[model samples]
Target: MLLQTAPAPGAWERLLAVLKEWDFAVFLKINTVWTGAFGDFLMPILRDQRTWYPLYAFLFIYVIYKFRWKALPFIIIAGLTVVLTDQVSSTFFKNYFGRVRPCNEEALRGMARLLLDRCPSSGSFTSSHAVNHFGLATFIYITLKPYFGKWGLLFFFWAAFICYAQVYVGVHYPGDVSCGAVLGVLLGGFTAWIFKKYFNFGNRKRGDLTTASPTV
Candidate 1:
């Protein structure tokens, strides 16, 4: 006969208590109150990666033209950062945690302001959008900060805006994006550090690694 083991006392209750206190209030406000033409126009665009291809193409061209061959390692770092964030957020966090998305929550069915035409059929504990955007932003900024100064940091705000749109569009909760942000920042820093120290990516001086020449 197998030995009987007792369940941990208040485990479920403790988890519920944390979730209850984590400000689902702000989530409801952002999802419901932020609706309008700007959201109508921007949220769907934010949700679709294809919509940003032109921007992506331009960014790569600018980086390559500005930094030449030396920028290749940094580009690889950014690509890996995004891929890692996307995979970790979806496969590990979303699948393992299996939290219900706001649009799919039974309690929020009528109330959650879903802007997208169709809701995703996946869990939303940690948003892949937030992870990928923030991760890419952080790693790229880290690599390019010396080269572009404060201007390089703008990518972070862009990532933040993208994450905000997720909450407004009702695809994710604030807590989910928050977790994703933390994860992204960590992973981004980690990747940047690896590239710098182990991969012979060179020193903090932009001139030492990549050219400071202005593009035409």
Candidate 2:
């Protein structure tokens, strides 16, 4: 009888190793520095709940009103999917993996980096910011695809920017953000598909009729 084995790390680790090599280190450092400069300006905007919360709230409400009751289920499901992805990536996967944040690692100890202060002993295998932002953006994109036509590409760029910002801030490794992004895309799309199938928001069946016509 053959024994079962866990799957290999796949392309992500291979890519990370390439990035970590001495030859690539200089390139990574330069890119990181440039990204960090931009991140210094963008992180505050991305990280601020005050800014995003109102924006998301307004968008959600507007979507529901614009699309009518049919949009409510999608909005609610997308919101829940975003929260769930964030919690799972941050609380479960991070704690279970217990990976060290890139900012706190020995390699970065003496380097001057731009970012908010490092998190206090938090696990860092997968970035919550990357996961949540990508997940929510992806879900919204999927839900609104029919409405947006070819413009759905814009949402994809939005998700990618947020994922890149995570690494730029020095809080997450590129590998971490990459994994989070992949997972976020899968989960977001899957959740939208499931909601569309089961929610029955637009379909009204004959069985839904409450009363029959009089026989007079």
Candidate 3:
């Protein structure tokens, strides 16, 4: 008798294929259909690393000034979070999936609008920009929420805007950003939990917060 494959596996494959089609359709909607002059001008700027250098510098100094030596551990962990997410998304997921970017996709040869002068030659899935920003956003939101309260929520929006820019510029699909966001959140949350449990800055209230050693 011939061996038979399970029907569930076939169904799962069909479901994945349908989801991929939807992902592509949504990507086109964002990248091509839903667009504006202001967005076209601003998105590339929003996604540019150089644009955020001042902000990054400010945050680095602010944290050290705010927490003194205690901020050192937090800084190290935050840096590690970005490094981990970038490697996982760019090195692992992108290589494993090997999906071509919309700008490079043969199917979108004439349909896609590529804003960049030249598209990146890397794989498309799980955008590293999305992963890194979301990871940092989640880490910042979690670690600093106690001090910043509702204002910390803006970090998520900041990350999301960067992710949108990635799709708008035709470098990544919606699914890529979505999955990257989820993965980033997971890794960030885990690191945050570790920091809180072990390398906690202090237990002092936000108002009464003062210098404290990095200890549990």
Candidate 4:
């Protein structure tokens, strides 16, 4: 006869306590919306990926102008960064966590101040917006850090604001955004590092990660 070992003392309880605390904090923020202007500003920025098409196209074009054909490889890797972050955050993490989005929460129906009249019909433990943008930001930052120095940091701030907008619109909790951002950073930073190492970026031996970093 074997004796079963008990789970770590109070560990589950502590975890539950932390989750409850976070949910309480989320409740506070969801009801704080104050302006039509804010919603107008954030909705366009937060929901529509197409809204940034011109900027994305401009970046691709600008990179090509700066580095010519060498820019093609980095642009491809950038696409991968978006795919990794968006898919993992939305498909895997959201389903695995199975937490209901604030917008979809029955209890929050009356309480949460919504920007759009509609909410997506999906699980929302992780914010896809945060993940995609942050991941892209991290990749871009690492790729261009050598040439642009401290200026590359702006990408992280840009990603953060997008995540904040998700919370403001009552779609995701702050924890969801925070966790998504962490995952994005890891995915982007690790991928960029790998690209650099494999491509011999330090010596520019086999087409380094960057030929000329753009100021934009």
Taken over the whole model, the C-alpha lDDT of each candidate is 0.79, 0.67, 0.85, 0.75
lDDT of 2 at 21: 63
Best by lDDT: 3
lDDT of 1 by residue, 1-216 (tens): 998998775988889768855647778888887678888788878767787678678778877787677667767877898899999999999999998888888878788887888889998979998888888777877766666678878878877888888888888999889889889998888897777665433334534545454322
> What TM value does model 3 have?
0.90
lDDT of 3 by residue, 9-120 (tens): 5788999999989988999999998999998999989988788778678778988998877788888998999899999998899999999998999988998888888899
lDDT by residue (tens digit), candidate 2, 55-147: 578767766665566666777798789888988897898999997776677666666253665444788778777677777777777766555
- TM per model? 0.83, 0.74, 0.90, 0.81
Q: Give the candidates in order of TM-score, highest first.
A: 3, 1, 4, 2
List of clashing residue pairs for candidate 3: none
What tens-digit string does per-residue lDDT give for candidate 4 at 87-172?
A: 89878998898988888888666777767668887878788988888888898888866655788898788788777777777788
In candidate 2, stretches whose alpha carbon ends up further than 4 angstroms from where it belongs are 1-32, 35-39, 47-50, 112-114, 200-216
After superposition, the stretches of candidate 4 with alpha carbons farther than 4 Å from their true spots are 1-9, 30-36, 43-47, 200-216
Regions of candidate 1 where Cα sits further than 4 Å from its true position: 1-18, 199-216
Clashes of 3: 0
**Residue 185 lDDT in model 2?**
81
